[model samples]
Target chain A: MQEVVNFIDLNLIMVGYLFIVGFTGGLVSGFIGSGGAFVLTPGMMSLGVPGTVAVASNMCHKFPKALVGAIKRYKYGQVDIKLGLVMAASASLGVQIGIKIQQIILEKWGQAGSNLYVSLSFVLILVTVGGYVFYDARKSARRTDTAGEMVSNLARRLQRIQLPPMIHFKTADVRISLWLTLPVGFATGMLAATIAVGGFIGVPGMIYVLGASSLIASATELVIAFVMGLGGSINWALHGMVDIRLTLIILAGSLLGVQLGAIGTTYVKEHMIKIVMGTIMLIVAFSRGFAIPQYLAQLKLIEVEENTIRILSAVSFGIMCLALAVGAVIILAAMWKGRFAAEEGAELPDKGSSLEVVSQES
Target chain B: MSGRSYARRKRPYGKVIGFGMLTAALYAAVYLNAPVVMTYFTKGGVYAVLPIATVFLFSYVHGTFAGSLWSLLGIDAKRTRLQERMEKRPAATRKISRPRPRLHA
Candidate 1:
């Protein structure tokens, strides 16, 4: 109890930091479906909060934020409740398996090894997946008249499979075999448990595999995040790890940011979602990459001075913050551009008076 | 535009202020009694419900306030074609497509 109390010594600066990060993180999450945790956990730890407490509090704040975001997006007709529920169920199961794997690694290689494993996975996954998404976004941006997200060939083939118990997701407008959804959901869960950000995999899976538009895929991810975060928070709370003070402060900023982000979606082009997501992922990968040397040094695989390791760690944290800031800037700028275009459209004659400037690309 | 959307576009400052006050009071109560709140909240076991339930309450009140505030500020979702399609999504009664059986020669 004393140790916990000592660890939670919050002040004005700490409160402001958490609130700002929370707002930016919430904005990105609302726009891209899942993010902020990759930065939030470490940000809290840097403030002297125990890692477990940071994670628990972050999880506590996440579900409600996601719930609010989900409802807001659902109003805009973006969320597919059925698909989200299905993915959530599978993801729950995958989380347990992912935790088991972590335990095994922890028992064998200890903390340094576990950290190394996580960093390597973060870099590899982010680079490969982020690169693909960014490339696709660029291709889509080049073509001005492409109306909505084009279904991928892989998704088309998967939909053709006549496996039993096909599910029709109304919002996503994709009829895919139930069997196909399981692996994607499972992988999403595993990644979430492993990396603390499952939407990284979940949104992309829904987009490239399930054939959902990026808009629907990102919106539906909030549902999955809500379900997963709720369950995870309960487990953490039961263990007495959640710091409600931290949770509430984050909620204060995130609630406003989330609603703003949700509305931003209705204003922006579809490809903008992919662009923001891919950019964040790639930057975050670079951020994680910077920390690899320290972990390697800890394992005695490389000799490094303490000062150099400290510098690397600080660099990594700065880069992660850069990722969040970049995402927030893009969303805000896009929203401003969209609003300006709408006002311009409103001034034109009745024939040109459209509520949405759908052709406006940034 | 949907009537509901049009109605939403008209700022409802009343609901926003009402929820905003309640949310502020709730946050004040929790923060003012931080010592007692922390001791009880971290007691573990069934007492875990306290934090969980508290968050749910905050989310509902605060979330509603935030939504209204955004609407008041004219940051509402636009009536895009995709959004319209979503709003008028076909009822469940719509025919479900089944895979056509194919026979290999």
Candidate 2:
């Protein structure tokens, strides 16, 4: 067995950094239904915490934050618990396979090569999916009366397939083959193991493939994240990798953020979820893109100076933070606008009543 | 909103304060005894449950506090009559129909 790494000493500045990131991460996660944890691992690592410990601590914080967020959204009548559980059931298996793949990569190419593979996967997946989601959101935004999510043509087609074991998801209002959910769940779990953000795939899959609304898809993602995070955290804890102090501090901020994020969801339009998720995914793709060059250098596939690699690493981490910050800003702005609109609607006299009075006067 | 009007809204201050205090106390205990907590938590066997248990405890306590704080601030889910109506609509139950066996085909 490998020797465990020592935990980093927490100064006031470090504590503050963790709390702020945790809050924003929680906020984004709550609003989008996928966690803000992708950044936390790197965020903790940047503060001199070991990578394993950072990941373990991040996982430890994730399940609890997700549990909180899921419950809040459930109250809003957005969550589909049955769908989440079904997806999670397959997703847990995907995580195991994903871990096996990672282990194989680590053994074959060592750490640098494994990192390059993860980064490349992040860049490819985030760009393709994020681009599509953002484009769809933009199209939806142009419509005057976008009250509910339109089921994707692909999902509708999939729903017609009557393979034995058709499951009905009531909140999502779709009945699709159980076989169809496996690939999505598996991919979500695999990605989660690889890049630590399965919700990227899970939420989008639920929305587009399974024909769930963005609201339900995102909310249900909390369930998948909670289940997966708990399973992963237990595994890491068994290895003595979780740093309780780090977990607790992050949890402190995330709990509040998650609830606030969940509240923001009820106030906003459905496309806004796609917009936030898409935008973050795109930005995070860039962040991961920046890291690829350094990993290439580490693997000696490209000749680069140590100083340049350091600078690139810093830029990558900065971009990652920017991705999270951008998501948080968009969510906050959308929430504020939604709240203002709601209040104004409340204050204004009924247009129907006014029209009736004018007709009577005439 | 006026304080009196705000009071009429009926925010759960008691739950907020109670959970907040408990969360704070729990945090203080963990941090103040950081060395001991770290040592036992990382023992890598049955001790693994400590971190899991601790986080679950915090989530329940602090999670409630956060939820209450938001409610107290009047930051809440949109309560449109339409949404209420939609929610009140009973959940659809799936009716699976089995094919009857034919005596002769």
Candidate 3:
């Protein structure tokens, strides 16, 4: 209904591509509680959106979707809002500081250097943390008696501390000091600013470092996400870079995906959450890792053909999409199976049974 | 049984229509003003309040509508376990202990 802008028309093709991207990304976000943005931003750019517009529009869409997902998950008693909010607030500050740091890098090294830094950070965090998560999940899945309890030693040990301004996250069932919580939120923001998805670190940091359970951590990350996305979107929108059409398109699919993802959370083990995140992260690392050499070539640190670089970039984006796709599949499959089991589990316990107390608690 | 049951419990049609129109209007206003609103919001420093304020506004208007819309559709969560848990709140609670004090790099 609007006049066409550039050659980039908001025709059926653009709309359809964005919808699919949103669906896939939303599916991933719902399960992992964070993602989609990393790929969404780039995906939009491919549709001829300016890099800044893609980021801003993606951010605009992300917060609402996250809010939707968080609320849905909260109903399941998974969200720790206070924790998420506090973390989000501090994370906002971290985003500011992280942006400043990026600006400094941008000034000194220019685009090539900045790109390298972003790429390097992506590889390091995604590979190390993602690999660790995959390993831990595999180990946990080997045991059946434990069922949904993959609480980390770090979280358990951290819960023992008594610091000032201590917050009690009822959902997480752990009370870590505000001092410890600040850094988690801050780092989460910093990394989010750098890598586009705070939950990549926020979720893991909560579990392995701050000691929140996976369910609580993933749910809580949504809070941090809404905060960061709001802050970041403002920054980009200020530049007049947000493409509202793109934002809305992504929102349509993500809203549905996130809702499904949130509901999907109900059917899986806590460790499955870790497994999903870790697997995606590790795969994404490979996705980004493949392009490192080309960036190096750009810096003249290595010699590579332009054709080679172009191929690597395409491959890299392909892998990123694949990673998101795989995550969506795992989450949906797990949720479906979990729901089936839950339905079966729901049977034996009749309305007036003694198990009513347990059902009510749930 | 299904969401069909939840749908039966939704508020009347008039209220739903009113809410929907209001939300659509609110979003229209925000999007139409995005360029200026967003620019001033991200000015940084004291101007940083712009972004934060807009977010709060969006959260309230957009967030509430989204929540209610989902609920009306019978897509609401199964009821919050956190609320029941939060009800057990006490006068004072101790913070979780930290073995290693994390430092920023």
Candidate 4:
């Protein structure tokens, strides 16, 4: 009795949609330690779910997935639980504040303006950060034919800060001021509220700004993701927006995907992780970028063809899928090459220069 | 720390039965009488119990299930290998510290 897509009922065949999206999105999350949500919410909406239900269900599913991923990484000694928790606590606070600002815009200008604001944020932040990560990864890949170098001068400088209350993060292998961490974590939550994908900022912030290694940053992100997702879901669930069926189905795929991705982390080098994270972020940014014009039209900045809008939305979703596909390929290929090389030798641990951090956990 | 010790321990059947019963009761409360459960869960009141309880429940049951299920399927992460490769996360860790040269020079 629910709405259909292409003559298919959203409520009925939703099971199939959930399974595929869950599996592939989970695959991406496992590789990058974040990003399944970017795919999940939109995938559900495409099945004719209300925007509220899609976001709520996605959040509901996210925490458990992150929890599982975190535990796996912990066993790998990649998670800085203390750091993740601190960031999570602050990020949740930021989420509330961000939500308040979103509400203000929504109340004042209504839905179109709110949607425009979110799309614009997504386009803006993703483009800036994602493009940078992608470029860095490409450059490093060229020099050494490996993917493990840190290109962010910012992280190195942050590490040199000698501010008070210095804290040591074992997995991250850095001792930095606690104050520096707050802004990164807070920005993560704010962006999460604005665009619903905070890891795009969180992972980069941790690696580049906070001076944590890519491996630890990606893994620790699961902890922060768990906290934020749980908090958001509860807020949304109180409104009956979470469809438990939808949440559970996605979890089925994600659980398996997270396990694989977690194991993958053991086999890859450090920089490869950044490569995957940056690649996904840039592609997703582009996906959001395409939708900006449509939202602008809604705000009457310009009037474009309705067919053009529909086509653009379709293209955005396609790019999102392509992002996931590319991530999976990078992870698999890197791991394969590593395993082959490791087998021929004495399993010599690749130096910091040659390691891949992100997918090694998977 | 070794897998050998883990292979020796046996959990009591009574404990397993008790846990199963508690889990069954929870499912009954949430799924069987969903309308009544939904009443409190979706209230959106100041109590905040509905959403908090749901996350707590999922975190426990589903979390454990995913963990053990992966182990059961032999999908566990390789501990020794991971210990070697884990660097501070790739995002924040500075693998390089070379400063840029000044253009004026």
Candidate 5:
């Protein structure tokens, strides 16, 4: 490995940009459990940080943020540690395989090919999964019984198989075969390795296949993220790819944002997480979709004007930033509304009671 | 009565300030000694421990500060009736293993 590090000179404007981006990304991660990387990586790259450094620094920051988020959710009785650990065990193995595949592709077809491969995978997975999640959230929203328990048809079917060595998740209120759980963890790891976004698959898989509710799935995904991020960070650090400066600066803002985001989750309903996750996914898919033409041009697979490619790249990054911003707004707004309503309910008197009657009753 | 109740909800000012100061000092140290720290941390070997350990330390310190900061600002999770109900429920029983049939003598 070449030891040449392309560390960017940090100016005031760059610092400010990174801090804001970090806070927004952290907020989203805190709320939904496993995003923020999809934004932070591109955000750093836009500021002239190399792709490897951005990824490594993001991974370095991720474990800590996930740790804090997981702990907070656990306090809320939203995390299933046993299930998270089981899934993480398989996910780590999947990450190793995913990395090996990427290395081979890099060796065979060079940088452009690797970039094209990553971009295509991002577009494909994000579209299919994001589209389904969005549709599910919409359907759930349309239901008259908003407070009713969510049941996944696929999860129900999976649970009926009665495969040997069934595991029960208490926090999630789920019982399913151990073998059935492995694929979700494995796919989460593979996707994390491929596009550096594991939660996209992990959260949905837990909800749809393992019969975990969206709330538990999102919270549990943070545990998987913590484990995966720690391992990935160590691997990247060993390769001398991590920029500690970037990691710390981002952490400074993200720490606060993540706490607020976690608190926000407590205020909102379960479906809100799905809505945020799906919205971010669809927007980011479009962002990556835009960047594909540029990668194709690099590989000489298609002829496109340089200016057009440049514009597309810029628009793609902007859209990515927009996704993070939109997610942050939704989380904060929901939290505020929920808090306000709770406060009002606490203060309001009963319909038949005046202030004097309420006071006497109290 | 409302004022009294509000006042009774004590803010974690001490924790916020203490952790905030400690976090600031750590950041200052890293920034002041950036060259030496960066060089040693990126040496690619047992040096890998440096970055990992540093992040964990920051998470503990800064994470606490952030949590306290929010509490002080009155941004907290509402204790809902549903959550209370869930908390009070008895733990679910785990399925026990059934005995296998014995082989014929």
Candidate 6:
């Protein structure tokens, strides 16, 4: 039997919806380096595109977007290419393992089981990681002297270990054991393969565990994303799963949004990246949690009315969109404020200095 | 820098328009002949290269166009004096602790 490609008919409205979503997703991705896919894949599926095609097309768009972003940041002297390449190599291996595990689960328990596993992983990883990032950002925001970037305690401990073959990351300005860097990259690749949004983990891991600044971590994640996305896109393309039309249209919008988002990074403080990332992560975690019940019901793990399940699914999707929108809003608002402050010659106080100055003046 | 001075920065209008037209033409061709392109693209074998190549082509052409378009609009990264100083500074070094061999007790 010949397999039919499920391509959705594109009306003007659908094109507009995709463009807007792509732009917003691109904006978030450019700022953080890994968020656009989390929104884009689900957005495409909602528009009647099949799950496989949506994932494939999103992957197709991701590499190009990441490539463009990486180039832009590299010019800004933010990207550490050597670090990015090393991480990417290990991440590619992790992706293979992740895909194999996904395939095994699909074969064992079918679609419902596969979905439940994905959701469970999403919820578990996002909450723990996101909560910690949020707490760290808030704590950093409250400090009185913000002369330097705050290195996480874990990262400090990791850097102290006298492991041989410590490769120096010049741009990120950290020298750590090459062995420690592999796990961060591998975990990034694994999560990326599983969730289609690996940057969330990759960026945070670099900052908190590896001691890279938020700027360098976010910029470097684009390199990892580019490598993994290219590999994923090739695999999907080989299966004839990519819809070129969808990929191009999304790319058109993202190309513009991503540049803006990358520029946004320069105007704002480093902690802003963490704030946006943590906020989006927590919200998306909640959204996935909302969808898990329906998958559970499908697996006969729980009994729920069809109407309630439908409502839960809709809310889950709505929350995902909301999370992306909230992230975009925060990025744009901060960028605007930063730009305005710069233009007016109103030098913004360093992160923790604002409160101290206000008290002293009073 | 004042807004006027920033606006005076050279804009890549020529590159923007040139790539813009090329991008538009490519998009038009794809949309107009969607069926044929779709058929070949989904053939699922050696033909998979079509979609992959097509996206890479669009990204390069259109990505350049989008970048120029933003520069023309005066939406750019702020090159603050502080940022310049930070970029010029030497890379910070971390103290590497060497492991000492313990004598046999």
- Top of the candidates by lDDT: 1
Please give the distance, in angstroms, between residue A60's alpha carbon in candidate 1 and its true position after superposition.
Answer: 0.4
Please write out the lDDT profile of model 2 over residues B1-105, one tens digit for every residue.
Answer: 122433357889899999999998999999999999999998877889999999999999999999899889978776533244347877678666989878995
TM-score of each: 0.91, 0.91, 0.78, 0.79, 0.90, 0.91
Q: Which portions of model 2 show Cα errors greater than 4 Å? A: A346-362, B1-8, B80-105
Q: Model 2 over residues A3-54: C-alpha lDDT tens digits?
A: 6689989999989999999999999999998757888998898888999899
For DockQ, candidate 1 versus 5, the one ahead is 1
Error of 6 at A115 (Å): 1.0
Error of 5 at A356 (Å): 33
- Model 6, range A32-136, lDDT digits (tens) per residue? 888878878888888899998999998899889999988887766678888899999999988889989999999999999999999999999999999888888
Write candidate 3's Cα lDDT for A32-109 as tens digits.
889888788788778787676677778888887888788777766678888898888889888889889999999998
Evaluate candidate 6 and give its CAPRI docking class based on DockQ: acceptable
Error of 3 at A116 (Å): 1.0
Assess chain B of each prediction and give its TM-score. Answer: 0.74, 0.70, 0.56, 0.51, 0.71, 0.71
First chain TM-score, candidate 1: 0.94
* Local lDDT at A224 for model 5: 97
Residue A43 lDDT in candidate 2: 85
Per-residue lDDT of model 4, residues A131-209, tens digit only: 8877766665564443345536776787788998888876676678888899889999999998787888888888788
Give the C-alpha miss distance for residue A47 in model 1, angstroms. 0.7
Summarize candidate 5's per-residue lDDT along B26-80 as a digit string, tens digits.
Answer: 9999988988888888787788999999999999999999999998987776553
User: Positional deviation of A142 in candidate 5, in angstroms?
Assistant: 1.9
Clashes by residue pair, model 1: none
